[model samples]
Target chain A: MELFESGACDLAIKIKTGTISSEEVTKAVLQKIEQREYDINAYITTTPELALKRAKSIDIQRIQGKDIGLLGGIPMAIKDSIITAGIRTTAGSHILENFIPPYNAHVIDKLLDAGAVIVGKTNTDEFTMGSTCETSYFKPARNPHNTGRVTGGSSGGSAAALAAHECIAALGSDTGGSIRQPASFCGITGIKPTYGRVSRYGLIAYASSLDQIGPMTKSVKDSALVLSVIAGYDNRDSTCLNEPVPDYLTEIDSGISGIKIGLPKEYFEEGLDSEVCDITMKAVEIMKSEGAEFIDISLPHTEYAIPTYYLLATAEASANLERYDGVRYGYRAENPENLYDMYCKSRSEGFGIEVKRRIMLGTYCLSAGYYDAYYRKAQKVRRLIKEDFDKAFKTVDAILTPVSPTPAFPLGSKINDPLQMYLADIYTISLNLAGLPGISVPAGKTSDNLPVGVQFMGRVLDENLLFRLAYALERNVGTSLTYEGAVV
Target chain B: MSVTRKDVDNVAALARLSFTDKEKEELIGTLNNILGYFDKLSELNTENVEPLTHILPVQNVMRDDEIKPSLDQETALKNAPKHARGHFVIPKVIE
Candidate 1:
């Protein structure tokens, strides 16, 4: 395999053993980024000079026989939402187009401490409000598998970069399938750790309760390895669990024999593309033949997940986004008459159309006289969704479902209709609403040659179980996707 | 209830945002369409269920009132649109 095409784990070992210099690997990946970035639009900023400097430093450390942390010279991409000190981290939004964070997010610090070199900041949906990267102030990231289609977003850039071999692995934040759905679309392995699994201190807030930072990689083992580096407690984010991070890399190799996987009936019903369903079922058959048990289960409240998620996410988003007035940082409107006018005009001129729409909806939901009917009710339904998963986990070790109803769709297909775009997240939204961990691993492809992925949803903090199942499925039935732009 | 143009205007103001007439018209249609989806949640009886504010069982993290290192005034105001005398400059409110 080409140096840039090697999995993160493989590249890490080679770099650590002095078999390949970190500079060489970083150069090859940067070359791939230069070659593919024009067509893919996979990054908002490419820090080539900084990446090379970090790579050379790691190389020097290896020569000096010093401890080079776990990742040791791996060129990794970061989603633009995570704040990196001195790097322009635009959450694919115009308001913060020139914003450079003053400090690194907790995960960025962890990844850097682990010797991961920062390649650049990947693109995202503006404030992560949409399912596709089309909402970005910068144009959408084209799916690497087929350049005409979208890399399902709002982590589209990270997914595309990983699939196109522009980076060894990438970090993506998930709030209602931003990471997993895009991973599925781009034919990569992405895991959204359990709520509070990773710190949110430096993340650009988008639906704070649902947002999670996780890893998007080319291999299941890499996902486990990256998650291990990024996961654990941080004093900065109060919601972060103080539990001990487990050894996912060692646990991933364990077989899936006798592991019970549940097939939720609602996921298989109408709206799912036939080819996507068939591919997911084929994965189930492979696991079944390997002695894993599949049970037919019903998460009866599944139909309510979309509404519940939209209401709560937008409500929280409205409040979370209220800080972007023309006061401190970000875009400020000119010639405002007064304080109120300044706040209104700065936000109106700075935000994109979909962002404005979400802010309005969120505001209306939480407004006086309507709170009980919308925001409060959604929270109640969210509880029911959580209870449904809690009930299912009583009998099954994990729940298996398709990551999206269909594979990568052509760009501009669902961008106009907000409702239709929201529906695309139906299969993945339930997991986030329930605050659980899930992994999207490639299953196979559709007849059109588009990639498809199946999700393994686990109980809260049970990422180890999800990793084991995803690893087995990836080994048994994973598609080896190759794109035309994958030449290193 | 379905969102109307008036509601969009009011909500936009509450959100500290403004829109053109055409954008307002478009928002009225889109907001109502999305709000219509929320009606689906009404079908489920959540009468007895308590609202889940946070998923994890975490509570307020109290700590000693000790001084800690933080961003200095200059670094904190580095990205500010307008700053002078170690403070953010905003449109005059008292005046």
Candidate 2:
């Protein structure tokens, strides 16, 4: 098998058994990235030298008969928003185009300790703000399945890399379907662990309460492996939970005989594509045949989720992004005549159109005259939205829904309409709002052959249940990989 | 309440963004549309609903007040567009 096509666990075993050297595997992946990166736009930076050196060091440790950590020498790409010491981490924005971190994020530290080889950073929507990767200051990532379509954002590049076999597995951040939607679009598996299940210590902040770092991979088991290495408490992030990390890999393939899945009625309402709805329902039927029971669930505040998310996210973003003024850090205008001009010119040039739009909306909601009407009211509505999920989880092990209203839209299709763009996150945003764990597993393809993802949301820290269900669904869904210009 | 073009302009300025006249006109329409949709919230009886800051029941995860070393000023300023003597440089505020 091609090095990039090798699963994370398979690669680790091969390297340890002397069937393939770590250096050889790294070289193959680097070569594949060099050949295909331009078409997919998967990577923002390629660290071939560092990757090869790291691979060699791992090989040396293996020769010394030392037990390397889980995922030793596996090539992994990270979302650019993640901080990697000495590596340029842009978050797909011009504002921090040259920014290099002096410290690693907790995930990065864990991945390195596990002996995972870091290939490069992948692209994202600038500051992880868009559903489609189109808003990136860097080029929008193309869906490896079809070049005409987008790989979903803000972790579009990470998913795209995984789909195109540019990397074995990649890291992605999901604020509102950033990871899952893109994973769905790219026909890969992605997981968004419950908020605080994974530490956010070195992730560049978007909306602090909603942003979560998660895993994107070619298979469900690979995601479980990656999550095991990264999910843990950290002293740096106060929000990170202090609970013991569960043995996720061991829990896979646990029988789904008694698992009860809930399908929310509102998720299949009118705006859902007929094809996506059909595929999702068929997935439910398959689960039922596999001895899973289904129940109809209602999350009545679904209508308010998009609005509530926007208000709260933007309100928080307005405060979180306040540090980016020309005074503190990031890009500043050249030769400004005054401080006000410096701030205006620098931000105007630094942020892309989408980032600017969110910042404006955020500032407006939090502005003095509008705080009560917008920000405060939205917080109250946010409670109702969370209550909707809390009420649903009482009766079900997990709630199932479509990842996006439709499969990946064509690039530039909804870019001009901000509201239309925001609505794309409808099914996924409420999970973030409720701070629950969710995963997007490829259910099947539409009749037209575009991949559709079925999302399973679990209660807080119930990622183990989510993964077991995803693994079962993944086995039933079978492989649906599609490449542009290739026969499905 | 109806949002006006002046509201858009003021918010844009406060956010430190510059927009073209055409972009401004377009955004005025979009923002108004979004705000119109949000008007639905006013009809709901949320008088007794408590505001939700976080969904998880986590709170007050405070850390000790002990001083820990911070990133060096040079490293912090490394990404600044302009810097001088380990500090980010900006244009003069008042002259």
Candidate 3:
């Protein structure tokens, strides 16, 4: 495979063995970014100088015979939503357009410690409120395969980075299919670890309860490699689970024989694009051939995931976002009559359309008159959504579903129709609501050659199962996805 | 379940945001459409279920009371849009 097509693991090995200098790899990736960035719009910011400096240091360390961590000298990109010290971390919003974080997020610390050189921060939906990169103030990230189509988001830029070969791998946050949907659209491997499995310290919160940091890579093994580095407990985040991190690199290729996978009837039913459904069905057949058993199952509350996710996520987001007052961090209004006016004007000027819509929905729901009817009721329904997974797990070890309802869609096709845009994530939202680990593995493609992905969801903290399954599914079907960026 | 223009203004005020008349009109339509989805949640009977605030079973994640170093005033004010004397500056609250 070409250097751009090589997986992060292979690149790291080559770097470690002195076969190829990390500087060489970083330079090649940077050149690719320069070549294709105008068409793809994947990165919100590029750090070519810093990446080369770090890569050169790693090369020196190797020459000195010093130990380098597993991701030694690998070039990676992070979602702009994750904070990095001294880097302008805009969560694809104008509000913090000039905000350079003073502290690195926990994941940034981990990625750096693992010897991964961050190339840049990638685009996201403003405050991660939308499913496509269209909401970004930096502009929408286009799917590399087709310039007219969107890379699924709010992790669109991370997926785009991998698809366009702008970087070897990337990190993204998934709250309601932010990571997986874009991975599906871009035909890359992405996983949303079980909620709290990875620390959220320094990760800009959209909805604290549902967000997770995971890897977006060109191959499944690299996802495992990256996950192994970033997962584990940290006292900085209370919600981070206190558990021993598993060695995913060693566990990824576990055989699939006798593994019972659930094919949720709700997922396969009407509303799924026929091409996506066919691809997912083929994925199940591949698993069956590998001796995995498929059990027909029903997650009765599947249809309610969208409503529950939006309500709970927005409610939390409304509260979480209140910290962006004009008095403190981020953009401030030019003039204010008083403190209250300052707050109003700053927020009004800062947020984008989708963000404002979500905040309004959240405020309306949490209002005294409507709290129970909207926010609290959604919480209860959320419990039932989790309960659906609890019941399904009794019959099956993991669940298989389409990562997205369709492949990448033309940009602006559903931007005006918020409801239509929301429905696009129907297949992937339920996993977040249930707080389960789900990995998107590329499968077949549409007639027009748009890539589709299949999602394998496992019980909370059962990310091991997800990695193993995704690895096998990827081996069976992940080949032939060599399309690069389109020239605009 | 339906959102009106009056509802939009009330929610926007609570959210500490404002909108132009055109934006407000658009918001009213968008709010009603999204709420129509939330209305579906009311169809299910959740009368006796416990509200799940957080997914994991964690509470009161406390640590030792030993005093620890913290972000200095300078770092705290690093991203402040308006700051003076090592503190964030805001519009006057008094008349």
Candidate 4:
């Protein structure tokens, strides 16, 4: 395979062993980005000069007998939401279009410390409010498989970048299936670690409780390798778990023999496309052949997840986004009649339609008369959803479901209907609400040749199990995409 | 339970956001559509269920009182739209 076509794990080995120079790999990826990025629209920014400079330095360090960190010299794309010191982190919003973060997010520090070279920031839905990249203030990232379709968002750009071989691996933050859904669409492996598994210090907060940063990669093993580097506690984010970080690679190759997996009946009942259901069941058959048993389970409250998520997530978002007034950083209105006018005008003009709608919805939910009726009630139901997982995990090691109800729809299909778009997350949002870990591994493709990924959700902090199962599926099913170095 | 235009205006104001009349009218429909879906939550009995704000078990994540270096005035104010004398200049609050 070409340098840019290899997984991060393979690239890391080649760079470490001097079999291939980091400079060569970096050049190949930069060239790939130059060639295909226009078609995919995966990145909001591309830092070719900085990436090459970092790659050269890492090459020098390796020559000088210096330790090149875990991902040393590998080119990676970061979700624009994560703050990068001195880099324009727009979070795919007009409000922060020209904003440059003065400090690195916690994960950026870890990646830099590990010697990973950052290529650029990937596009996302404005403040990650929408599932499709169409909601982004920038051009939507079209699926690498089919340019006419979306690369399922709000981490759509990251997924597209990886799938298109524009970058070896990428960082994606998931709040209500941003990472996993795009990975499913782009035919890549994406993991949304348990809520507190990764630090949230630099991630532009959407819903503080639901937001998490994880890895999207070419293979399940690459996800494990990247997750190992990024998954650890930092004092900057209080919600980050102070638990011990496991070397996921150690237990990754462990076979999933006698592992009990659950199939939640609610996920299959309605709204699930027949092809997606068949693909999911086919993935189950492969796992079953590999000695993993499947059990019928009921997450009775699954139907309520969407409503619960919209209420709670939007409520938190309304409050978290309140900091973006014209005062500190980000866009400010050109001229204003008064302070209130400036605040109102800057925000209304800065934000897009979906973001404004969410803000409005959130404000209404948290308004004085509706607090108990909406936000509080959703919180209670959120507990019930988590309880469903907790109860099921007692009987099964993990649960299996389709990552998205259907594969990537056409770009403008559901953008006009907000409620219709919300239902797309019906299957994935429950895990986010429950603070559980979930991974999307490419299963197969639809008749239209679009990719489909099956989701494997595990108990909190049990990412190793998810990786093991994911690896088995990838190994046996052989659904790995052929990177022919061509952009459709 | 329907979100009227007046409610959208109130919420938009509460959010420190202003919408054009057309945007407000659009929001009235979108907000009501979303809020109407939220009515599904009321069907369940959450009478005594404890609300889960954060899923993590850790709370009151305290740190020591020791001082640590923070962003200098220049770096902190670097991105501010209006800054003077190392302070963010904003329209006068009490005028």
Docking class of 4: high
Error of 3 at A63 (Å): 1.0
Query: Tens digits of per-residue lDDT for model 1 on A1-488?
Result: 78998888888999999999899999999999999999999999999999999999999999999888889999999999999999998899999988989989999999999999999999889998888788999888988889899999999999999888899999999999999999998888999999999999999999999999999998899999999999999988988999999989997878999999999999999999999999998999988987799999989999999888989898889999999997888999998999999999999988999898888888999998899999999999999999999999999999999999989999999889999999889999999998999999988878877788899999989999999998888777653334322323
Q: Please write out the lDDT profile of model 4 over residues A262-335, one tens digit for every residue.
A: 99999998789999999999999999999999999999999999999999999999999999998899999987
The interface root-mean-square deviation of each model, in the order shown, is 1.0, 1.7, 1.2, 1.0
Off by over 4 Å in 3: A479-488
Which candidate should be chosen as best, given lDDT against the real structure? Answer: 4
User: Residue B43 in candidate 4 has what lDDT?
Assistant: 91
Clashing pairs in 1: none
**Candidate 3 chain A: worst-modelled 10 consecutive residues by lDDT:** A479-488
User: Which residue pairs in candidate 3 have backbone atoms (N, alpha carbon, C) closer than 3 angstroms, thus clashing?
Assistant: none
* Candidate with maximal DockQ: 1
Off by over 4 Å in 2: A479-488
Q: After superposition, how far is residue A21 of candidate 4 from its true place, in Å?
A: 0.9
As for candidate 4, its clashing pairs are: none
Note the Cα lDDT for every prediction shown: 0.91, 0.86, 0.89, 0.91
lDDT of 2 by residue, A1-488 (tens): 45667788788899988788889988988888888887889888889999999999999999999877888989999999999999999999999887888899999999999989999999999999998788889798998888789898989999888877888889999998899999888888999999999999999999999999999988888899999999999988888999999879898888688888999999999899999999899889888887889999998988888888898888788778777776766778788878877878888888987788788888888887889888888889888888888888888898889999888888889888888888888999999988999999989887667788899999889999998888888888764332222211
Better of 3 and 4 by TM-score: 4
